[model samples]
Target: MAWLADAVVALVALLHVYILVLEMFLWDRPAGLRAFGQSLDAARASKVLAANQGLYNGFLAAGLLWGLWLGPAGFGVKVFFLACVAVAGLYGAATAARKILFVQTVPAAIGLALLFGARA
Candidate 1:
């Protein structure tokens, strides 16, 4: 179960990294524009902002990976980052897109649940 938690955490981190790449590197590209469903002009207009957002996503991934690297001692770190992800997802869902709830919040929620269950 702990392994499962770790796996989920790792996957979340990877997901964030992928987002980072999409937003930072590809936000103005066809891939990023398509993924975000933004028009090319809009993507170009907000490229800088998207890159900043991507950097933050990279930070989130870094934090999760850091927690994982700490082994059992990283429980607090994992929880904190997962909570951040959940909250962010919720906010995004409310303001940005409903899909965010399923994409970001649910997975973090699942990871947090597995972490708690593993502890139990």
Candidate 2:
């Protein structure tokens, strides 16, 4: 159970890192445009904003990784970072796209549940 929880947490972190890449390095490129459903002009116009968002995602990933590095004592850190991801996802779903709930929030929720359940 612990191993499974750890894997889920790592998966969530990797997803965030991927998001960071998409938003930061690829926002103005075809792949990012396609992913975000943005026109080239719109993507170009918002490149800086997307990069800022990407940096936030990177911070989330870093937090998750830091929690992982702390081993058994990292429960509170994991919960906090996972909650942040869940809230961000919820906000994005409301304002940007509903799929954000499933993409970002669901995974974090699952990871959270697994993390908690593993302690039982």
Candidate 3:
């Protein structure tokens, strides 16, 4: 069960890194623009804002990694980060995109449950 929790945390961390890349470096590019449903020009105009959002994603990734490295001490950290992810996803689903609910929040919620329920 601990291993499962750890694997889920690791997966979430990796996904965050990918999100960071998409928001920070590729927001104005084809993939990012397509994902966000924005034209290149619009995406370019919002590049700075997207970069800032991406930095937050990077921070989440860092926290998850730190938690992973800390073993059992990581439990709280993982839960916190996953909670953040869930909130962000819910917000995005409400205002930005519904896909965020399934893609981001659901996985994080599952990971959070596993982590919180894992045997010590």
Candidate 4:
């Protein structure tokens, strides 16, 4: 169970890292355009904003990795970062895209469950 939880956390971290790359490096490219359903002009115009958002995603990934690196001693850190991800996912789902709920929130939720359940 602990391993499963850790795996989920790692997956979430990787996802955030991918998001960071898309937003920061590809915001004005074909890949970013398709990912965000933006036109070339729109992507170009919003490149700066996307980069800022990407930086935040990078921070999230870093936090998750930090937690994972701490091993069993990092339970609190893991929970905290997972909660942050879950909350951010919920907000994104509410304001930007509902798909974020499944992509982000659901995975965090699953990880949370495994973390707590494993302790039992």
Cα TM-score per model: 0.99, 0.98, 0.95, 0.97
Error of 4 at 99 (Å): 0.8
The root-mean-square deviation over C-alpha atoms between each candidate and the true structure, in angstroms, is: 0.4, 0.6, 1.1, 0.7
| Local accuracy of candidate 2 as per-residue lDDT tens digits, 12-106 | 89999999999999998988988899999999999999999999999999999998999979888888999999999999999999999999999
Candidate 3 residue runs with Cα over 4 Å from true position: none
Candidate 4 — which residues are off by over 4 angstroms?
Answer: none
User: By TM-score, how accurate is candidate 3?
Assistant: 0.95
| Among all candidates shown, the one with the greatest lDDT | 1
Clashing pairs in 4: none
Q: How many pairs of residues collide in model 1?
A: 0
- Residue-pair clashes per candidate: 0, 0, 0, 0
lDDT of 3 by residue, 1-120 (tens): 999999999999999999999999999988898888999888988999999999999999899999999999878888899999999999999999899999889999999888878854
Q: Write the per-residue lDDT of candidate 4 for residues 1-120, one digit (tens) a residue.
A: 899999999999999999999999999888998888899999888889999999998998999899899999878888998999999999999999999999999999998999998878
The total of clashing pairs for model 3 equals 0
Is candidate 2 or 4 superior in TM-score? Answer: 2
